[model samples]
Each structure stands twice: as C-alpha cells, then as structure tokens.
Target: MTKELKESDPGSPSPNVLRIILALRKWGWGSFWSQLVLAIIASIILIATIPFVTRAAAPNPNVPIATAPSPGIGMGILFTVIGIGIVYFTAFWSFRYTKLAQKLRGANGGERPSKLQTVKLLKTGAIFSLIGMPVTLIGANAIVGALTIKSLTPQPTGGYVGVISVQPIDMFVVQASILTILAHFVSLFASLWLLNRVSDKPTN
Candidate 1:
C-alpha cells in the first residue's frame, strides 16, 4: 500500500527525502532533549555555586581575603555564563530540525523549503555548535585550571575554617562546565549527522 501510494502520487517524497526526514526527526528530538536536560542541570549547579563561591574567606576584614578572584577564575565564570546562553540557543535549534521535518512531510509545496535552504539551515546549526564547543572548552579550562591551582596552593589562613579554600566551590563549577560541554557535543554530533543525511544524493 505504501508502494502503491508512492507510485500513484508523483508528489510523494523520494527515498532520499524520506531518509532525510527520518534523520531529522530522530536526531533532532533526541539531541534537543539531551541538550535541554544537560543545560538545565548545569544551570542548577551554577546557581548552587553562588553561596560557596561568594562566602567570606575570613571572619575579620583585617585578616584579608583576596580583593578579587584571579583572572582565570573570573574569566571562567564569564565564559561559562556565555556558553550556557549558547547552549540554550543550540537546544532550541535542535528542536528546529523536528519542525523542519514536519514541514518536509507536509502536502503543501509552498511550505516545503528548497534543498539549498534546508542544507543552509543544517549548516547554521552546525556552525553554532562549532562556536559553542570552543566557548565551553575555554570555560572548562579556565575554571578547572584555576580551581586546581587554588587547591594545590591554598592560601595561608592560620588554620582558619573556610579561609580561601577551593574545595567548597570547585566541584560545582567543574560539574556545570562539564555538563555544558557534553550538551554542546551532543548538539554538534546531531547537527553534523543530519547535515550528512540531508546532503545525500536523492533517488527517484
């Protein structure tokens, strides 16, 4: 019956088009959900980090805490925040593929995108993921490197509790950055795979 319908209806999608549609739906939704979950988890971790990160290093102002975090740590937080925003965008972009699939499957020719448009759309998503990869990496490196350094060379605090130690906040930033990296990776992989599927040669 499926074959008969295809044979009878010249407007039915070609094999390649069907395959592309399938790829879009499968990887698209899968990537979106995974990215979203990771992003949400990462966001929560970042939020949980605030108290630990902002805690006073010493009870008395005279005993002194560093006036500010090192450049690496500060930059890490900045980039991580930016990367999270990008992850959010990529998550939605992942969802765009499923919507594109729906459009491809519609009967209205006007609603269907040209092949070039579709490929361009996939490329845009791929490029965004590419951008996100570096951003998240920078954040991960900065945060982890700074945290490791602080852990190894803890400040002299005369054995004061909570005095400029890295342990309290290290895991929080590290975990969040790691999740963001994984989410970006998922977005990139799905975009590239779907891009390949859509770029394949069509069969009659």
Candidate 2:
C-alpha cells in the first residue's frame, strides 16, 4: 500500500518572508546576548573605575599625584562610557523586539509586514532611547563636576568653609535625573509591548 504525504498549506508564507523571518530570528539572539554582555562589562568597568577614582582623590604626602583634578576627569570618562553603554543596550533590545515581531508574523504564516510597520516600530523604540540619552549625559556630567568641585577646594585645615552655593548646572542635573527615571519607565513599557505582541502570535 502507498503512503499518503501531507503538504503545507498553499496560503503559507512565501519563500522570501520565510527567509527574512529566519534571518531576523537569528539576529534576535545575537542582539540580545551581545547587548546583555556589553551592559555587564560596562557595569564592571564602572565599578572597577571607582577604586581608581578614590585613590586619586586621597591625599598622600609620599606620592606625587594630582589629588584635585584627576579623580574628576577619571570619573567623568567612566560615567560617560557607562551612559553610552546603557543607551546602546537599550537600543539593541528595542531593535530585537521589532525583529522578533516580524519573525513572529512570518512564523504564523501571516503576510510579511509592510515598510510602514517596520518604520513605526523602529521610530517608537528610537524615540524612547533618544529621550534617555540627554538625561544620562547630563547626570554623568553633573556627577563628574560635583566630584571635581569637592576635590578642587578642600576645606581649610582647622577652619570651616562657608555654605556652598547651588549652581544652575546642579539644578539641571537634578532635573535630568528625574527625566531619566521617567524615560526608563517609558522605554520599559515599549519593550514589553513589542515583546508581548510577538509572543501572542500563533507560531508554527
């Protein structure tokens, strides 16, 4: 007796869509793992730099080190690198989510998404990522500046320094911190929504 073979549905995804989806799925894992690893590395670097900063700030009679200016610059570079790393990670996650959505649609045997759909996902993700960038930069600068200021003018020995004046830049930094927190929540929501949409699709 001859055996019957089952064929895939004619309405299933075309070769092009299937190929695109497979490519996107492959990229999703790469993007996620790379971003995660980079974020971890950034955190480690930032943490390790703290000791260098502290050593630079300490007063030492035996060693000839510029105790005043070095710590501030070191800290500034560290924070800036950290901020950039965070932004890059967030952007990677956003891009991954968008790709995952496309892949899900393809896997579900649905028609390939249009250019507009792709653009919309990217635009929404990018907007959130951009919003956080300035906040991160400002906070990092503020931290470096504050550290520098404290290091530069040490309190007089056996004498008290007068009340420190709050600068406009300080206020800007404070506001930026607040904004950063808000932007983080927004980005989180966007990421979750994108992920949820992808997961909800019926997969093959």
Candidate 3:
C-alpha cells in the first residue's frame, strides 16, 4: 500500500498499485507520444504552407473578371494555424498525464493526486479539443470551399487565362487542418478514456 512496494505493471497484487501502474504504463505514455507526434507534423505543415498560400499567384491582369480566389481561401491557413496552436496546447496538457502518472507511482496517500484533480485535468484537455475541433473544421471547410471555387472559376475568353490557378500546394492547407483535427481528436479521446478510467477508481 506504499510507493516502496515496487510493481512494474498493472497485474500488481495490490489493487491501488495496479491502477497506478496501469495508468502509467498504458495510457500515460500513450497519450503523450501520439499527441506530440501528430501535433509536430501538423505544425510543420502549417508553417511550410501558410506563407505560400498568402503569396498565391497574383491576379491575372489580362482577365477582366480577374478574381484570384486562392487568397481568400488562404485565410483558412490562419485559422488552421490557430487550431494547430490549440492542438499543441492540448498535446502539452496530455503530457502532464504521464508526469502525473509518474507522481502517482511514486507517491502515497496525501502525496498523490486526488481523483478529483485527475478528473479535472482530463476534462480540461477534452474541453480544449472540443473547442479546437470547430476551429480546425472551419479552416478545413474554408480552404476546401475556396479552392473549389478557384478550380471551377470561369476563365476569360480562353479555357484558362493564366498560371495563377490552383496548384498541388493549395491542398496542403486542407491536409494541415485535417491533421490538426486528428490531433485534437486524439487528445480528446485520450482525455475522456483517462477520465472514465480514473472515475472508476474509488480514491480521493
């Protein structure tokens, strides 16, 4: 019933120790690494693509109805970056779970986090993801909508007037936003799973 009793995994003979070990060895690092890796990839995409989006091909002067729609869609890049930031924050919060797990493993009685504290942390992470989901969705939708409009935009008398048209890079914004959404979802799921697991324990 104390930290001194060493057990590496959840099959510990002691019930409370088993909970601590299971949380630490199973979901603790699970949440940390998954969120971290996804967030990093998403952020990199955001950084690489946002600048190009803003600098999207200029308006074709020859076309009378020269309306380059990509710039407007570029706005999604901003929103997606914001979403990525939120995702990063949540990922960091998820890391705290691992740290908390370590603390739980090494502490006993008053030294350990209360069930309330653990639940609160998990709930906070879930809420963060809930908030981020809409932001990322908005970004993804905007980018797709704008790109679609650009792709279908009627050209000047010619089939297509100029090179200032949709390109493969344009899709990167959508990919980034989607990845961010994925990261947020991962964080959200982990938080809820941990929350439920912690709730089932009868510890203060």
Candidate 4:
C-alpha cells in the first residue's frame, strides 16, 4: 500500500517550512496573551499614576518657577519609562517565536533559521516598535506638559477669565495623548498577532 503524502511530510514540503509551522502553532497564542496581559496591566497602572502625578506637579502660584522636579513628576517619569520598557519587552518576547522556529528545526544541534525568515520576522516586530515609540514619547510629554502648566505665569487680562485655570488647549493635548498611547498599545498587539500569523505560513 502506498503511503499518503502530507503537507508536513518529508520531501513533500521544505523541512524548514514544516518546522516553522509546528513551532508557530505551538507557541503563538500563549506567548501572545501572556505578554499582552503584562502590557495591559502595566498600562493601567501607568494610567492610574497620572492623576497623582499631575496633582503633585501642579505648580504653586507663589513660586516664580519650578525649582526642581516634583516627587509626582519623578514618579510620572518613572512610570513612563516603565511603560516604554514594557513595550520593548513585549516586542522582544513576540520576536522569540522565531527562536522557537529555529529550535523546531533542531537548532539545538546547530541548525539556523533561513536568512529570509530571520529577516522577515526581525523586520515585522522592529517596524512596529519603531512606529509606536514616537507615539509613546509624545504621550509621555503631553502628560508632563499638562502637569507643569500650573507653573506658567498667568496671562494678565482686563476681563475675568474662566474660574477653571486649566486651559482647554492643555486638556485637548492630554486627551489626544491618551488616544495616542492607546493606539501604541493596540498597534503593538496587532504586530504580535501578525508575527504569529506570518511565521506560521509556508510562504516566504
């Protein structure tokens, strides 16, 4: 009796292609969700920290200028740094699927990923990371800008201005910043999902 040919069978498909498919299927979902949860938790904590940060950084009307960074400002900075770090960490974790592919090919015995595969995976995560990075920085800056506004010298006016001192422009910036940060997170998720899907495919 003749044996049935399989898409996974030796001589039926490229051996490396079969290994990559197996590795991606094994690692994709678990790797994605774990990192995703971490990113979300970190982001929420960072968001929660914002109010305290803005309150702390609120400039005193009496002070001519900010003498030094406020504690809240420092904490905000720390959180922003952490958020960015988490993004990079997640991207790197997603990138690990490639390694799993190599291992599936028995790289433990010294096999290597095809140059094309390696380059493709590397580019996917990297491009997303680069794309999100600017938005992250912008969001961080917006929060800092909003918090520091209290320090600005109030503009002299003949007529009474609104009681609320926070400028509409500042609030707009902050709102936009929130969207930008969320966009970065969503983009990161999409990038990881794409990496998983793309790596599993038999195509180049």
Candidate 5:
C-alpha cells in the first residue's frame, strides 16, 4: 500500500512520511505513559534530595545553620543549558529518524537496516542522554536549592551572609525545567519507536 501510494501519485506524501505517521500512531500512547512514569520517578528523586541535602548541610546540631545563596543567576543559566540540550537532542533524533526512513524507502524487499546502523543510532542517543540527563538534573537541583533558601532578609550575623531572595528571573528556570523534563521523556520514547521502525524487516 505504501509503495503503491508512492507510485500512484508523484506529488503524494513519500513512503517515509507514511512510515512516520504509522510509527506515531503506534507509539503515541506508549510515549505518554512512559513519559508520565519518568516524570513521577524524577519528582520522587527530587523530593528525596531535599532532606538529604538539608541534613548533610547541618550534620552537627551544635553549629548554627548556614544561609544558602540566591539561586537566581546560577539556576537561570543551568536551566537555559538543559533547555538547549533537550531541544538539541530532540531535533537531532527527529532529523536522524526522518533521514533513516527516507533511506529505507528505497531498500529491496525484506531488507532491514544493518545492525551496525541501528547500534550506532542507539549509541549516539545513549551518549547524549548520559551527558544531557545529568546536566539537566543538576540544573533542576539548583532550582530546588534556590527554592529552599533559609531566608532572604539581610542579617548581620555572619562573616559572609549570602542573599537568599528569589527573583522574577528564577521563574524562567522553573518554566524551563518543566518544559525540559517533558521534552526529555517524550523525545526519549519517540526515539525508541523510531529505532524500532528503522530496524524492522521490510514488508510489502
């Protein structure tokens, strides 16, 4: 049917286009559920981190509690970085999958993408996730830290009392974190589906 569609109408959408649509139709719900699971897990880890860090910072009861620094600038930068990474990775896989689909359109009957090609694509994705997930998470953590500062009010109680105030700019970090997390999981599942499609044996 896909081949017939391509042959019947020169202007019709390419076989690759149809493949993409089918892949989306098949994997869309799986993608959503997987992303939801990841988001829930990430939230749990984020929640757990707060108390651990708090306790670590004040291990001894005798010492006075130290003030944390304003997270505005640092978190804003980190968020921007992760946001860029998520976008880059998503865009990267989208382009790769589209190109692979187009390439497969010309294969002979029963042909499948070489194992090496599939492995390479998976490796590239894994490398990106390894680097990007950590960086994004660290940025999220910075936001958590920023949100949990002891006090923002000026206190003359110390040699170096840092400001703990939240600024309007910090909202960007929060927004970016939310978007990045969603994008990260959605892209992850979509990429997985694309990989499966590209690796599948061709059928008429």
Candidate 6:
C-alpha cells in the first residue's frame, strides 16, 4: 500500500508563488550568462564591421581631403558589451529571487519561508539590479555616441574635430535607455510581488 501524504496547514502560504520562484531561480542565471556572452561577441563583431562598412561606403573623390583620427571604436564596443551585461544581470537576479522563493516554499511543504530567508533573497536581487542601472545607462550612451559620430560627421578637413553631432539617433538611444531603466523597475516589482505572495497565508 502507498503511504498517504500529510496535508499542510490551511494557514500556510500558497504553493504557486513558490513554484514560480523556483523555476526562475533554476534557469535564470544560466540564461543571463549566455546572453552576456552573446552580447559581447555581437558587440565585437559590430565594432569590427564598422570600419569595413565605412570604407566600402566611402565616396570616391578625384580631389584629396585631409583626414583625422576618429574616436576609439573599441571603446564603443566595450560600452555596449558592458551595458548588455548589466541589463542581463538585473533580469537574471530578479528571476533568480522569484525562483528561490518558489523553491523554498515547495521544499518546505508548501509553507511560507522564514522572514530572514525572504529578506536575504530580496536584498541580494535588489542590490544587483540597482548596481546594474548606471552601468547600463553609461554603456548605452557610449554606443549611441560612437554610432552618432560615425553617421553625422564628415571626414575631417583639418585638425581634430571636437564634437561630432547626430541628433536623431541620439534621441533614440536616450529613449532606449529610459526603456531599459523601466524594465529593471518592472523586474524588481515582479520579484517583490512573488516574495510577498509566497510569504502571505493562503486565501482558502
């Protein structure tokens, strides 16, 4: 005969939230690492391609013109890679927290996790997400700035040209930065919601 399973207390938290958190934690970190690696590779490829593309698209001129050293393309690539890492890290941590909560609840017989456990998980996820925000913004800015320089400015006529300007693409990058920040906030909120739900007693 199969042994009967013991029922959990009615006052305990819902198992669903715990399940969600557990799933997130299991897969989130791995996904983040993969994304980061891919982003870095893509940035490197883009940076390498920029010069080739520019050379191929260069207008042929019978008349010669002076040229100046361009801003470092490598720096732009680094920035993009860093930004992608930050964004991916934030997303990963948020999901990881949710997953951990779920796992704890499920492992503990569908009961609420201890206050300390919840606090620890929340603290870790929030800290990383907060740290990632500035890194992402700066990285995005660098990429936009680099692309803008390439698109708007013509080959230099004399000594160094100080500020290369591109209005439209810069605007798009700024908007994208705002969207990224919003995404972080949304992820944080979702993590917190899962934590709260898992900690609260079940309704029925």
Off by over 4 Å in 6: 1-70, 108-112, 148-152, 156-186, 192-204
CA lDDT of 171 in candidate 3?
68
- How accurate locally is residue 94 in candidate 6, as Cα lDDT from 0 to 100? 55
Candidate 1 has what TM-score?
0.82
User: lDDT tens digits, residues 151-196, model 4?
Assistant: 4535444464322244443443344345445534554555555455
Off by over 4 Å in 1: 1-10, 56-72, 107-109, 157-165
- After the best TM-score superposition of candidate 6, give how far the Cα of residue 112 lies from its true spot, in angstroms: 6.6
Per-residue lDDT of 1-204 in model 6, one digit per residue for the tens?
001112265543345543444445543554345444444454455555445435534544643322211344345444544655566666666555545645554555565566677667666666665665566567566656666665566655446554444434234444444455555555555546555654666553
Model 1: how far residue 97 lies from native, Å: 0.5
Consecutive 10-residue window with the lowest summed lDDT within model 4? 1-10
lDDT of 2 by residue, 112-185 (tens): 66645654654565565666566566656666576456556544442655433433433333343443434344
Q: Rank the candidates by TM-score, best first.
A: 1, 3, 5, 6, 2, 4
Q: Compared to the true structure, candidate 6 yields what TM-score?
A: 0.48
Task: State every prediction's TM-score relative to the real structure.
Answer: 0.82, 0.45, 0.79, 0.38, 0.52, 0.48
Better of 2 and 3 by lDDT: 3
lDDT of 2: 0.50
Query: What TM-score, to 2 decimals, does candidate 3 have?
Result: 0.79
How far residue 86's Cα lies from its native spot in candidate 3, in Å, is 1.0
Among these predictions, the greatest TM-score belongs to: 1
Question: How many angstroms is residue 168 displaced in model 1 relative to the true structure, after the best TM-score fit?
Answer: 4.1
How well is each residue in 1-204 modelled by candidate 3, as lDDT tens digits? 346446655533356645755674467567667777877888887777766555445555663433333757767877888888897788788778877775566544336666677788889989999999999899898898888777776565566565346766676667778888888888888888888777774664
The 0-to-1 C-alpha lDDT of every candidate, in the order given, reads 0.77, 0.50, 0.72, 0.50, 0.51, 0.51
Better of 1 and 6 by lDDT: 1
* Candidate 2 weakest lDDT stretch, 10 residues: 1-10
Scored against the true structure, residue 18 in model 4 reaches a CA lDDT of 61
